[model samples]
Target: MTRPKTTPLPPTIVVVFGITGDLARRKLLPAIFDLYLKGLLPSQFRLVGFMRRDLSKLEFQTLIQDSLTKYHRGASSTSLKKFLKLIVLEQGQFDDPAAYERLGEQLKSLDNSLGVCTNKLFYLAVPPALYPTIFPLIKKSHLAKACESARAGTGWTRFLVEKPFGRDLGTARSLERQLKNIFTEDQIFRIDHYLAKETLQNIITFRLANPLFANIWNRGHIVRVEVRLLEQEGIVGRGSFYDEVGALRDVGQNHLLQMLALVAMETPATLTAASIRAARERVLKGLKLAHSDFKESVQRGQYEGYLNESGVAPYSTTETYFKINATVTTGPLRGVPFTLESGKGLPVKKTEIKIYFKNLKLIPVEVESGEVGNVLTFTIQPNEGVALSLLAKEPGLDYLVTEKNLEFAYATGWPDRLIPSDYERLLFDALMGDSTLFPTRGEIIASWQFITPILNQLNKLPLTRYRRGDLPSVS
Candidate 1:
């Protein structure tokens, strides 16, 4: 495989909204440092952290330095020094219009010093509540206005928004409206970090680039698709947030469904963002679940003793687990059932998609039956790689068929790999003005549409409760 040549990026500034937040400390900052160490970041690039904390620029630098040191042990002090030199801190409340104006001035100064009108990527790492205030502030401060470089067909400005886009369809639409008023569809990126995972992106290339899988990736050969994202630990400190937004919206609606689309979407005409997103949007719109199909097809659950957890309401009915079966109405995989199951406090942590292909049942000779189906599994976590389970006769005698897994483990097979965190890849894409892995507004709304019904019916369905150390009893 040939690597794409690294094109030198124009000078740019990345402004993080929630600089002091856990996400920035643990994921975003480390990703930036990694990019810098790899020489992927432009020499003229700068990082500006915006938060309401009353910390000085030096304090903010120290905080980021501590975070990078703790989270990224592999990063060297030399590279860290170079990266830290790029840091700048600004203090401001999200609702304060004046703060945005100050930020605008700071950006202008940077542009002037760089001798070019630089690009900007605003990453809203803050809470959803702040979105309303921040976006309008950005618009009013003229931050969203096209930069001079943009007019000359050089620079670009983009917004990288983190999800849950909204609680449901109505709110999702409202957020969409808010975004459109400030930024164009092409300029807004709804970041789904799962899409940045190596295996997740590889799904497209695995299908289109390889004729062996592409030819049979259809309903005729595929029986059922299972997407499972199980976690060993429950929502530890996110009880307040998790309780309000249950498993369905938290994980099933976005991460799980995103994987399903990648698995079920047809081959795009071209590999561009527009073509790939259009294909995904088509699949999302084609997802069919009649109102009556909810009971038999959807299953909800909760881990026992959730109410006893700190920050949870007494007698909380919020589901800690969710599983739903859906069918696609278009493309070669139409009518193929997609079963998506996700939950916290499961037996073990694993995120994978299992494509169970039809077995060779028509074979004349009968062998002792086992799990005989040809299963293609894309493991996204714990062990990130692809595996194919084929039926093979057991050695020495009695015709017994067994499953043999031929595996490609990313962590092992690809030794000395420089795989970046999902944030790194996503932030890089946003900086480079690539929206391939980012979800579009249409895709977001369509996903909520597919999920809203199940969420609405969550109360009516029976939610099984199991021990924290065990998988949900619903299965």
Candidate 2:
């Protein structure tokens, strides 16, 4: 595929709400610096770090330098110095009104220095609990509005929100209402970093562009779909947060469902954001648990040492692992079963989608009963690649069948290509006003509608216990 032309970006100011947070240090700041290195950011760009920490300008710069060095290695000293020049720190508490006023003044100063109204991208990198506190303050400070008095409203404002959008449907709806009151639908960019991964995006392109796969992507040709997101690391420092959230809400509702939608949704009419999101939303709306009884379709498990983890309750029923069987009731995927599983502290860290194809019974060649059919896999992480497993005759006189893997890895297949990190691609897309990689409000709501019911019945279902590295029993 030919590379698309890069468009010039407008002069903009990015205001990161929680600059001291882990996400900012690890992903957001690193991504922004990468964009700077690539000259994707405009010459008049500025990154305003909004946090309560009162540090000197030099101190803030040093901290950011350390972060870049740790998270983004091999950055040249010259580039680091140039990037640091764009950093501006705003010391303020989330609930402090005076702090917001000062931030407004700082933004005005930035605009004045540019001699024109600049676009603003506010990144709420903080936790969801602080969203309510910050949302009203932004509106009260008139930060969401364009500068009509100073300039003729040439600038646009966008909000980038991270996910686990909400705990459940009610909370998600409430959050939507809060955001709607403050910002318009188009102004809101709901970040689902998974959607921005090269491999994930390729799923749509691979299906649509390749006639070989597209022709057979349906219930008739496929058997069952499996979307698995497994992690090898435990909740080490995040026990408090993890204990409350568990695996289902943390990934099942967002990542797993999103991947399943991409795998099952019909070919979109066009490749635009509207068409793609509409296709996903339709699949999400039609999804339901395969069994009415939650226990029959859902399995929950807690890691063996979860109780000993810091901030976790001794008798906590929170599930660190979950496996769900869901079915699509509409479209061409009707009656197809999708196994969505996610867990922490597993033996391996992997995120992939496996599509099983029906085996051909008409063939005269003898095949073992244990031999499965062709399996097409989209590996999202650990290694970004796609592989198709097929039964082939073994290299011997006897006609024995063995599974052969035809793999395409991004690293080996495109050695010189610089694949952007999930956060990097997402941040760049947000700046370019491209919402194709982000989730829509309707998609979020539809996902929650399907997941909320299962979550509600989770308490009644007994939680199984398994060791950290062991694969939990599904039955």
Candidate 3:
């Protein structure tokens, strides 16, 4: 890909919440450093760290170094040094009004001394429990007011919140209300990090731009849509939270559904961020989780438990895998059943969405023909790229056709440079105040509304089961 020659964004100050955590050290800082090294960071920018940690500036930079340097081998020392000097640390705790005030003063002092504008971006890298406490704290601290007073005209102040939007629709609604007090609908950036991936972003573009797909991307021509999010390993030590949320809340509600949304959304007249979100919002709002409604359309399962993996566990019933046969009620594909499949302990590592194209194969019939039709599969992980399988000549006698697969690998034909991690890319966007990759309020609300029914069903029925290392399927 050619380097994009574009003007830099307005100078901005980035405040990272939970700055000392794994997310900040591993992803946020590296992404920002990459942008800085690439000359993409604005000339007058400040990347501030906020959390309970009492690390000095040098110590904070060291924290980022220990994790990010190994992952971002391409980064230069000079760029990291420049970024570190611009970075600062401030201590703040949830529900503390004075801490927010002091943090605000730091932003003010930096703006005045550095001659930087007051555009501030707050990243809530903290847990959801901290959100209901911190949002009101920011509102009370007058950081929102500082955004108003900045010379840059309605000084840009936006907040980026991590996912697991809420436990259910009611809780999600409450969380939104908590944020509504301090930030406008547009001021909040809820991240489904998967949405920020290059290939994930390329989904609709790959399909809509090509006439071969746009013409037949409907129930009339397509038989089914299979969307999968697979991981080769188990939950590891993150079971404290994963046990409660399970696969549905962790990957199902957001990422898998997001892919389905992009595949199922119609061709909007235009593809602006707002327009595209509007299309997604329409699909989310129409979601009704009646067990009877989708008796055939939806399926859920959990992987073999940690305590019961033969000798892996003595005996346990906790599920680490799940599958859902979701039906979207929005866009041109409304009422269309999209198979949402994912597993925690799969046989191998693979994440792809297979689009079942109808009848392009000239179907196997008479003779020894082995035609199985055509399918366009978009793989987002492991071996990243697109693959298409279709019937082809067997190179033997006439009518001796056989099934053949063709793949276009994105990783193969790219530049030698490494692509930033999904978390890195998203954090960089937040720092630069580009909210296009983040999910909006409408999208979050719609997601919660769609997920509420599934949660209710899970609570009512707990035997959802699947074997370890088993592939995910609707059956």
Candidate 3 lands at a TM-score of: 0.90
Question: What range of 10 consecutive residues in model 2 has the weakest lDDT sum?
Answer: 146-155
lDDT by residue (274-324, candidate 3, tens digit) is 777777777767754424655454555566565533334344344466656
What TM value does model 1 have? 0.96
If ranked by TM-score, best first, what sequence of candidates would result?
1, 2, 3
Using all chains and alpha carbons, the TM-scores for the candidates as numbered come to 0.96, 0.96, 0.90
Instruction: For model 3, give the RMSD to the true fold.
Output: 3.4
RMSD of each: 1.8, 2.0, 3.4
Candidate 2 structure quality by residue, lDDT tens digits, 1-475: 2225466766899999999888999999999998888888877899999998888998888989999999995788899998998888999899999999999999999999999789899999999988989999999999999655425434889899989788899999999999999998888999888898888899987887899888888889888999999999998799899888988989899999899888888888888888888999999999998887778899999889889999998899999999999999876678999999999989999999998888877564455646478889999999999999878889989867778899999999999987898888888888777788888899999999999988888988888899889999868
**Model 3: how far is 119 from its true place, Å?**
1.7
Taking the tens digit of each residue's C-alpha lDDT, what string does model 1 give over 73-165? Answer: 487878788788898888898999999988989889888989988888888999887788888889999898767668665678888999989
Number of backbone collisions per candidate: 0, 0, 4
- Runs of candidate 1 with Cα error greater than 4 angstroms are 1-5, 364-369
